[model samples]
Target: MSRFRRTWLQHSLRAALALGATFSLGLGNAQAASTTKILVGFPAGGGSDAIARILAERMQIELGSNVVVDNKPGAGGQIAAQALKAAAPDGQTLFLSHDHSITILPMVTRNPGYDSAKDFVPVAGIATFVNAFAVSGGTTAKTFQAYVAQVKQQGGGKGVVGIPAPGSVPQFLVQVIARKNGLDLVAVPYRGSAPMMSDMLGNQIPAGVASIPDFIENHKAGKVRVVAVMGTQRQASMPEVPTLAELGLSGFEEVPFYGVFAPAGTPKATLDKLALAIQKTIAQPDVRDKLTTMGLSVGFMSSDELAARERSYAKVWAKIIQESGYQPN
Candidate 1:
């Protein structure tokens, strides 16, 4: 090749490489596309997985990048939390979890494999949600009161209640309920909501306490009846259902939160950028409607706000878990 032509070709290649590098670093408008992954610590089709998928779709429109969800379901999200800790904090990986993995796990687990305080930083707080006490199809009881009465009359005040996972918030709620109602209720823990839900549908388990989303569809289909929700107020999607507080049960008035977190030391600019994308996604009417339908009180909280909220929730559960006399396994 001629010298001039070779020189021009070399310069062109250099410029293209520079542009690609900048874009790959998530810099500059009109940049090349990149992939961001949202990790869930549960199986697909679960509440957190569903929320991550929904937000990821809308977030792609806002951020103009490919977004995906990766599930690492095990040990009540321990595997996924450990994965997040080992990931590079380049803003490409995020963990979507509720207060269980971030708040309850650390308290109830001897070592959950990740340190939320040091290994992860809050990206965004999506919404607050409630746990529901639901009855299987084989049961005749409708209201929470009726369920308790039936258990007492038929089962000698001894009953079995299912929870999605052990050491979870739902289990603690069960303990509280058993004590309050004077029922000797034993909480049977499961690996995930899906199996626990299956038991509820098939009448293998008479009752369960899980996130409202876990049982909403089944409830709507008349497979299970959500007798009571845990929170200060009733869920808008199920206004007919009463809150535990309304049922004269106290200490469970506060709800749990859903949040996104990135590995520690991620750049502030990147965190802000992702947070804005999430905020925009959450602000979409369709997004809000979908999440609300699934029993989430859709709301947005900033990074700092999420940090404070998590701290406060930790304190909240700390008192509850301590009162329950739970020992980490």
Candidate 2:
């Protein structure tokens, strides 16, 4: 009674197991084909976009999904931030942005169209970068002090400077420097750093304020010279350059950050998973070196730590903006 029945039962069980494995394989492939997009607030050739692409390439492999970068450039990244707010809480869409969009935009704009606190949650912190003040090739000034002197000598201590965008932190920095120096300096805003760089290269603008990454390549190319930087200490990429504090311009020790964010209401588990993948990618030697070479201080911060750092950064900028008496746009 037993031999025939036992043999038949074993064969049936093996066939069922094989079918289940085949089904699971097909499901995994389908999931892998689903695309995950990282939204960048700046144009493609900018620092934020570069970082996003690098991280997306690595994250695609780590997350075992299709990861891609989507640029939404305008209004100092207001457009991209608004897109993130409108996105669903699913893990598929994320915003890869720096402090200007996440921390400072709200403070400067009356209505930036998106609220960081209410509409987004920090996923991870990628790196921190510092702002720089640079002059064009046509300018005779070799140093920021000399530039100011030239402005005083040639233009009655009045000059026009380029900024990455309106309501940007660099714009405020221009005011801070002008106020401290007792000169009339006005910041002319552009759409992004790339365009600002273009004007500087063509000598259409005498000087501009932007991130170190934005100007470092040109600084090396000799088209522009980074005369001063905003940080407590000098950068490794440009050790010869002077810090704002060294130039007797203090109180700007706060460094700007680049991080990833998911729309609010996204599950904590999903956020945590993405954060871990980012931490893994940043930990890679090649990724770290690439970002470091771009004048960034590459480091990973936890989601909660990033959120806290963002708030602290906002507070610092808030005071500076208020003291400058700059009206919100």
Candidate 3:
């Protein structure tokens, strides 16, 4: 063979191999893009985890990709929030949580590991849930007013109320209610709703404040009685219970919300795709029913709308926390 021809053939072989390698790398990137993960700050079998799983199933259908839920429960959702903050902004990792991790934690905790406004970009708002002030069936108080009178009559020092978490919305509400009504109700924080509900069922605590869903089952069983719900209007599930507004308590009408968020700097195109998928998922009749049955008021908000809502919610909680003079532990 001629030397020139031999050299040309060798160079041609090298170019072909390089081209094949590049094509294989491209396929890997596409596969990675096809998979998505929804991160939950709580363990499985809880409300947040259930929401994540439900959305993930529907999202997989809407997105035409494999979607999953990853639980990273710790530090009142700080660990999961931090993981998302440092994650690659590829839209694959999202945080599914409620107000505790997003709006209220930052206000009460000295450092919550991630800034809701700065570290994450809002993707969509899922739904809203109402908090309730409940008492054991064994209690003598038949109404919220009666409950207050009992607390005051028993003396301020003995008034204790159980809450799900220390820096949670229910805890702050307990403090605010006690101060406003001239009752010295002490706020007792528990790790989560499960234990708090258990204590309430055993009559270990006479009164407790938590999401209505957290106590709805027991309330139905006549194990506990929900005295008042904190929303602008009554819950459809518990229509007989009056709202804080109807009881003449202003500014207690705003319900806590659940939302999805991605790490900051996630591509706009990715965010839009996620938001659309979420909107579709929430619009499903069965999905809405499931959420409603689980105590969430099924609703939807677009990306931009959710962002604005978060800002407004944060501001409201900030004022409440400041007024209560709560210092983070």
Candidate 4:
């Protein structure tokens, strides 16, 4: 070969190698940017936090990227929702919350930090969880009817029930149940389920209302007795427990659900990818079992379906809140 041609060939090869190296580095950086952060509004050890951590672990495998849970427990999940609202719409940050922060909070409170419709987009629905009306093992009531009777016997000012938080679903449901039954049961709000459950175990309060997951373990250990669940149907894990509707509570047939949401303006592709990863993660047998054991049903909804459900739930809860005359603090 000629000397000029040989020199030109070597130069071309070196330039090609350098371009390839740069392209590889760009891809590496892009992949690194894919790390996901799941933000939980409640403190650790609560139902929402438990689900978030489980989903995060499984999502790491499904998404093929690092996933972490960031707990921002305050203001009944308002802080976490606000953080998510201000986050970059890059799909790396997600909020895992139930209806309290999404459907109910905005309706009851004047300013909940972030508007669900305007500031966020639904990614996927994780599962539905039932709230339970339970009493400590020390209580004499063995059934819902018996419990109501006992509360009635105690009379107006004496009956008190603990709730996970003020302005939460459990709190509102307590009011509805009390009014319907014509019993005067006052609600005592605690910071979260953990503390409420703590008080209940000590019998500081005779009864409490909280997500089934919050009470299931203790109930199984005979520390508490879940007399009834607030949902349309019975939970598979605790088939013996009756739904509130079965006991003539009509409007509460629907249970609260948990879902994932990202800040508005996240790319469609990113949203879809995250939704798919969530679906896959929830479908895994181990993940399904873990969530179920925690009193969550393994129901998954796609992004569009989740958005529709959220809209419908907000409307229904808005009417209920208005009727209840709950003023936001």
Candidate 5:
């Protein structure tokens, strides 16, 4: 070939490579710009998992990016919490967890390995709801009042009430109910609701406490009965079930809440974007209706409001922990 023709071919090759490089760089930037993930501190079928999935699906549409729900369950949410802080502070990764792992776990553990105040920034609250204490299908206690009387008769020896974990709201509720009624109810601890529900189904433990919604369908199907609802008022989903107060137990209110958080130092703009996405996803009428059907009310709060609520709840839980005589393990 002629030298001039060969030179022209080489120039053409160089131009093509330059264009490819530019396209590759642009694609990289676009991928980095578009992808976001929400991490849940529990396995699938758990409340956080459900919330993460719902938010991920909706937020993906709202934010125009692929939103993924990653479950990193272990150490009672410490694993996910630590992983969240280690992730890039670019709003690409978020943590969706409930009150126990975020507030209760740290307060009860000597070194939980993550500081909520320093390592994370609140993005938005997802939902808040109560737990219902119920007995297995085969249990003889049919009513909350009857359950109380049965516990009194057994003097807390005849039955064991299972709780997800120590220092959790459900655990405290168990302690409070047992103590207030002068019943010697023993708490059987489980890793989480999934296993606890399994035990209840198997009748390994006759009575158990779980997220209100987790047991709602079962209650509706007549597979189990709620003996007590742990809040001041009857839950909107289960109006027939009475609160602890109405059952003649005063001041037995325990409400569990969940929220979203990003790693600390994440830009306010990024967090705001995420918050807007969350609000948008949660504000839909269908979303609210579905969550309510699941026995969870729509609970969305601003960053500041969520932070303040966390602080106040921490103090209250800390006091309860001290009163319950719980020490870090």
Candidate 6:
């Protein structure tokens, strides 16, 4: 009917499309600017906190957003799990926990506040850490056999040993080793590793079980001695330390692991974004080297793989606990 009318209508459509594009761009930017908070279920200076801080630093730059690590420590991480359960499912918040908060806590406590299979979605695994049984330099035990000899000499075969917390991996390892060796180990539980080290140095505990890195430097400096490594293989940083398996204890390989978890309802898109960012960060040369030097093995597992790993450990730890006469309440 009219060329001018048709031309005007076409120009109007082009302008509308450009305006829609501009609006969409602004909305996306706003979404990206939203702060991402990661919850660490331990106090600062702990291993979990260290890992979360490292990952948070990389995530901030990789995701193009601000990220912060919020420490919520108490009740063996049940406090943090409850807080995470109440968090919105918008993928803005995540929980970084090791094996205790995920699998063991639920078994030991009546209520952990979050179910690993139902209330959370695994994002990515950061690393796996091997534990070590170490003693202060003043201890009479210089090696695993010597430790056994000292325990026997102590008359009751019940020697005081320190662990990070009750029902933690290190504690469980101590129980298992005590049973295997037919010794009575009165486990002394501490809030964290620092105090454990203090008591051990003060001779409050005759021996101690701790993470490999916690005493690695001390061992190297002749301040402490490692009796045995808990994992299957000797730690790379301490080749002289013998593994539990090598010491005639078969099937005692266990490592504490750290991974990222989101609220159960967090969208898959957000989880994928997080996993990608973690993979990129762990792949960095500096990050890899730093983690390795800390006596940790760099482990990058996908979400499915991480979940499977957790479940597998749950089954394994459950059996070990039961066999060790640990009646779950």
TM-score for candidate 1, residues paired by index: 0.90
Candidate 1 lDDT by residue in tens digits, 1-329: 99999999999999999998987676644243378889999888778888999999999899888899999998888889999999999998899999898988999988788789999999999999999999999999988999999999999999999998889999999989999999999999988788788888889999999999888989999999999998888889989999898888898877899999999999999999999999999999999999999999989999999999999889988999998889888
Residue-wise C-alpha lDDT for candidate 6, range 1-329, written one tens digit per residue: 59999999999999999999999999888876588989977677666677778888888899888999998877667788888888888888899888888988888766666777888889899888877889888887789998887887775687878987777777778887788888988888777676677777777777788777567666787878887887777788889889989988766675777788898989899889989999999999998887787787987989998888898888888887777777555
In model 1, the runs with Cα more than 4 Å from the true position are: 1-33
Q: What is the C-alpha RMSD of each candidate to the true structure, in Å?
A: 4.4, 6.0, 5.5, 5.4, 2.8, 7.5
Best by lDDT: 2
lDDT of 3 by residue, 1-329 (tens): 99999999999999999999999999889877888989887656557877889999999999999899998877667788989999999989999988888888888788787888899998999998989999987798988999998877776535989987788888888887877788788889876677777888889999999887688888888899998999788899888889887777767766788899999999999999999999999999999998898779988988888778777788888888888788887
TM-score of 3: 0.84
Stretches > 4 Å off in candidate 6? 1-33
TM-score of each: 0.90, 0.90, 0.84, 0.87, 0.89, 0.85
Candidate 2 lDDT trough over 10 residues, lowest sum? 27-36
**Candidate 5 clash total?**
1
lDDT of 5 by residue, 22-133 (tens): 9999999998778888887766776667767878888999999889988887776788999998999999999998787788888888888888899999999878888888
Worst 10 residues of 6 by lDDT: 320-329
TM-score of 2: 0.90
Off by over 4 Å in 3: 1-34, 137-140, 153-157
Candidate 5 residue runs with Cα over 4 Å from true position: 1-29, 151-156
Quote the positional error of residue 112 for candidate 2 in Å.
1.6
In angstroms, the error of model 1 at 313 is 0.9
